[model samples]
Target: MAQTGTAGPASIATGPVTITEVVQSALRDYPQIHVSQEEFNASVANIRLARTAYLPRVDGLAQVNRATRNNIFGTLLPQNTIPSISGPVIGSNNGGSVWGSATGLLVSWQPFDFGLRHANVKAARAAKDKADASVQRSQLEVTTAAADAYLTLIAAKQIEKSAAAAVDNWDVLLRTIHALSSAQLRPGADESRIEAELAMARTQLVYARQADESGRATLVKFLSRTGDINTSLDTGRLLSELPPGGDEEVPFQTADHPVMAEQRANVAQSAAQLRATERSWVPQFNVEGAAYARGSGAEVDGHRLPGANGLAPTVQNYAAGVNITFPFMDFASIHAREAAQAATLRANQANEQLADKALQEQFAKAQAALRAAREVAANTPIEVKSAHMAFDQAKARYQAGLVPIDDLAQAQRLVVQAEIDDSIARLNVWRALLQFDAARGNIQPFLQAVNK
Candidate 1:
C-alpha cells in the first residue's frame, strides 16, 4: 500500500519515484513472478485433466485398405499397418486383391470408481490452491526484495551526501588553518594535520560514492532493468514517515499467512492423494459401447468378391457392455497406498513444525528488531543536533586560538559520525518494518503504514 507516484512518459524517469512505484515495476517485470504465474496456469490445466476422468472418452476410427483376400493356416503378425485379408481359413491357396473400408465410434465411461476419481480431482484442486499460494509467495518475496534494495540505495545516497558535506567542511577548515599558519598565529603542524584530515574526508567520500553506485546497481537489477539507469528516489518523504506507536505491536495471524496457507494446501493435496490410493482397491465400474461397419474383399467360403462391391459396407455390428474390475491381488496398489500415507503424514508434520516453531521465532525476532530500530531512530536526530552545535563551537574556538586542532578535528568527526548514524537509524527502522511484514508473509500492511 505504498503510495504510487505518477510515472512520466520516459522508460526511466528522471524525477523522484516512490517505494511503491519501484515495487510495482518489479512485480510487473520480474522473471520470478512471471514463472510462478505460468506454474499456477499449469496447475489449473492439471486440475482440468483430472476432472476429465469424470467424463466419457469418445473416439472415432476409420480405415481403408487394399489387400489380397486370402486366409492361410500360417501365423501372421498382428499390426494395424499390415493389412490382412478377411476370409475363412481354407486348405487350398486361392487369393484375389480388392479394396475394403471400415469405420467405427467407441465410447468408454468410468461411471463409478468408488470415490477414486473424485479423490484425484480433489487432489488436483488442492494442488491448484497450493500453486496459487506459491504465486502470492513469489510476489511477496519480489516486492520485499525490491523494497529492501530501494531502501539500501536511499541509505547509500544519504551516506554519500554526508561524506561530501564532511569533505567540504574539512576543506574550509584546512584553508582557515593554512591562513592562520601563514600569519604564525597557528603552528604549521596544525595546518598539516587539517590537510591530512581533509584528504581522509575526501577518501571517505569516494568510498561512500562507490557504495552508492553499488546500491543503485542492485536496485536496478531488482527492477529488472538493463544498462545504465538513473534513479531519483523520494528519500526525504520515506524517511519522514513514522510508525504509529513504538510500543504497540502489529497484529498478525500465522494461519492466514501465505506460507502457512501453502503448506496447509500441500497437506491437503497429500491427504487427497492418500485417499485416492486407498480407493484404488475398490471395484471400478465402466460402460463401453462401439458401433462399426466393415466391407470384406472375400466371401466366407474363400471366394473373392467382385471389385467395387468390396468397398461398400457388407457387414455391420454394434455392442454395448458394462465392466466391473476388482483388484484382488494388487501388491503394487498396496505399496502405493502405503507411500501416499507416509507422504501425507510428512506433509502434516512439516506444516505443524512451521506453525509451531519457525513462524513464532521469526515473528518474535521481527518484533524485537522493529522496537530496537524505532528507539535508535528516535534518538539519532538529537545526537546529530548536539554534534553539530559542538562542531560549530569547536571551530569558532579553534579560529580564536582557544582550542587545539585535535579537539576541532574530533568535533568535526563527531558531526560526520552523527549524521551517518542518523541516516542509518532512519533507514533501519524502515528495513525492520519490512522484515516484520515479511515474517507475516505479506508487505501490504507495512506499505500502508509507511505511506500513511
Candidate 2:
C-alpha cells in the first residue's frame, strides 16, 4: 500500500491533474514556445518577400532643379576635390538661370530571369517549411521536459510519503520499547537503539521532503510559473495505464522524425540557392518603359529660351526599351556559384551523416531504457510484497521476544526501501515511454495515449 504525506503548502488546483493537461498548459503559456511560433511567422513573411521578385517594379518620379544654362569646354578631374569652369567658351553663351521641372512614370519588368527568381521563391518556401519543423521540434522538447519534471515530482512525493510512514512506524516501536524497558521486560540498550532508529527515520523524512521541494520547483519552472507555489500531483494514478492497443512495438523511422525533416528542408533550401547562383551566369532580360515631360532653358542648336518657356513643358519624351545584361567577364559570379554548390553538398552530408547517426543512437538508447524500466516495473511489486511480509513477520517475532531490536529495525528499513523502489520503478517506466516518443521526434502520440 502507498502512504501519503504533505511536503509543502496546499495546492491551488481543486483536483488531481493529468500529465497531458500539464504539458498542454506549458505549450500554451510557455515563453519559449511563443518564440518559436513568432519565428515561424517571420519565415512566412520571408517567403512573401521572395515572391515580390516575380512582380513588375513601378516607380513615380518628380523633380525640380534651378541651374545656370552655361556651357564650357575643359579637362575636368572626376574627383570631387577638383573644381571645373562652368561658363561657355567653345559654344554661344547662354549665361542665365532657369527653373526646370520634370515628371515621369517608370516601369521595369524582368521578362525573363532564367529561373533565378523561381529558385529564390522555392528557397524561401523551403525555409518556411524548415521553420515549421522547428516549431514542432520546440513543442516536442518542451512537452517532453514538462512530462519528465512531472514524473520526477510525483516520484519524489511518493518517496516523501514513504519516509513519513517509516518515521511514524519507528516512533511506535520506540514507544513500545520505552514502555518495556520501564517495566524491566526489555533492556535499556533496546530503548536506545529504537530511539536512534526513530531519529534516522526522521532525518530521512527531512531529506525526502527536501527532494520533493526541489522536484516541485523544477516542475514549476517548466510551467513558467512565478514564485513558490505548491503542486499536487494525481498520486492515485502513480503508474501509467497502458493504451487499449496494448504495448506493441512502435515503428521507428528516421526520415519521419522532425529533426530529419528540418534537415531535409535545409538541404532543399541549399539546393535552390545553388540553382539560383548557377543561373546568375545566364543573361537577364528586362522590359523598361518611361514617359517624361521636361522644361529646359538651353536648346541643342545653341538657342537661348525665355524664362517662362523654361518652366513650361517645352520637351516631351517617351521611351520603351528591352535590356539584356550578361556578366561574361565577372569572375565573382563563378566563385559564388561554386560556394553555393559546396553549401548544398554540406547540407546533404549533414542530413545523411550527422542527423542519421544521432537519430539512430537516440532510438537505440530509448528502446533499451524502455525494456529495462518495464522489467523493473513488473518485478518491483513482488519485491514490495515480499518486503512487507518479512517486516510483518519480524514485528511479530519482536513482539513475542523471539527477534532482537536490530532485526526489527533492519526489516523496517527494508520495507521503506522497497516502497520507495516500487514507486520509482513505476515512474521510470513512464519516463522511458516519454524518451521513446522523444526519440521519434514527436510526443503527441504518446501524450494522447497517456491522456486516454
Off by over 4 Å in 1: 1-15, 72-86, 183-189, 221-231, 325-330, 333-337, 344-348, 389-407
For each candidate in turn, the TM-score is 0.85, 0.82
Candidate 2 lDDT, 136-173, residue by residue in tens:
77877888898888888888888898899888888988
Clash count, one per candidate: 0, 0
User: Model 2 off-target regions past 4 Å?
Assistant: 1-14, 74-96, 177-197, 221-231, 240-248, 297-309, 333-337, 340-344, 392-407
Instruction: Report the C-alpha displacement of residue 23, candidate 1, in angstroms.
Output: 2.8
- Tens-digit per-residue lDDT, 113-152, candidate 1: 8888889999898888888888887888899999999989
